[model samples]
Target: MKILNRCTLEFTSIPENVAFARVAVAAFASQLDYTLPELEEIKVAVSEAVGNAIIHGYRNRPDKIVRVNVTIYKEGLEIQVVDSGIGIADIDLAMQPAYSTDPERMGLGFVFMQSFSDRLQVDSSPGKGTTVTMFKQMGLRKARARAN
Candidate 1:
């Protein structure tokens, strides 16, 4: 897809940065004709991706870096969250509902991301790291169709 706008944010892998990443990405995505609810979904997806990077990828370590790359394409908004920490061994198992590496935490992160975005992809290697990509389609066409 054609890129209309893009921005990248790099921050330490801390819990607070999850909110920052979500808000920053949502602001960038606002350039498109997305409804308020659509924007909220995007924010939730961003939070889950970044939170997973900090909690699971870095294992709560505060020094590692988390990168968020957001691109507004002609058809949708794409957000990628990357972390250079311990990666998942089995993506399928991890994606199952309530299947978190940590027993104390709910494993609904992937579920929320998948439900909120048009498409979701996760890439990782055992020792390398993890990258979560989520795309939310612009709502203008949907709204127009509904109006018609």
Candidate 2:
């Protein structure tokens, strides 16, 4: 896909930055002709990815770094959230619905990310870190409307 625009953000792995990441990505994505609901989905996906990076990847360590990269294509957009923290040993188990490392948490982050995006991929190793990539295609609403 031809790249139309792109941006990279690096922030401290703090919980407050989740909202910042969400709004920033949504704003960048608005350059496309996405509807309001689609934009909301984009925000939710971003929030979950970033939140997971800070919470699970970094283990709530604010000193760590979380990076977010967003790229826009003619067809849609791609979002990547990366953290250099403890990585997941079992990606398959982690992606399962309501499965969280922390018992207190709901573990629905991946579920929200998967439902909102056209595609979702999680890459991680035991020590390397984690990267969550999500793709949201444009004009999905129109296609769904026509189908119904």
Candidate 3:
């Protein structure tokens, strides 16, 4: 349903900020009655998204900014992580499992994000950077009704 609240956070693209973003999103999402496992999944998904923005988008440069927006609703939560840096040249190839530009790292970020969230979307331009949007349903209709 209706959006109960929304919050936007912007921070420098640093390694530490990745955890900050993850924790912040998980805390915001905790307003819903998600189980511990679900919360952990959310945190992991958030970490993946934010990490991708920092490691891939900003290339570990602290000068760039990473933006995160979260919307809470009775039915679910929606999150968006964005950065203004080098964007993906091929989204389809990027989404493929085990596909990565970096040779040292495993290309499971998109896979984790997809598995953890109910819906995942990515938008990017060659030089405009990337934005990853994710949604997770609370699946707590009975609980919501009871709370109301």
Order the numbered candidates by TM-score, best leading.
Answer: 3, 1, 2
Q: Candidate 2 lDDT, tens digit per residue, 8-116?
A: 9999999999999999999999988788999999999999999999999999999999999999987789999999889999999999999999999999999999999
How big is the positional error of residue 91 in model 2, measured in Å on the Cα after superposition? 0.5
Tens digit per residue, CA lDDT, model 3, 66-147: 9999999888889999999999999999999999888876999999999999999999998999999999988767447735
Candidate 1 lDDT: 0.91
Candidate 2 deviant stretches above 4 angstroms: 140-148
Model 1: per-residue lDDT, tens digit, 21-41?
A: 989998998888688998999
Compared with the true structure, the alpha-carbon lDDT of candidate 2 equals 0.93
TM-score to true structure, per model: 0.94, 0.93, 0.94
In candidate 2, the residue pairs with backbone N, CA or C atoms under 3 Å apart (3 or more residues apart, or in different chains) clash, namely: none
Q: What are the candidates' C-alpha RMSDs?
A: 2.8, 3.6, 1.5
* TM value for model 1: 0.94
Off by over 4 Å in 3: 140-148
Clashes of each: 0, 0, 0
* Residue-level error in angstroms, candidate 1, position 127: 0.9
* TM match of model 2 to true structure: 0.93
Cα displacement (Å) at residue 126, model 2 = 1.1
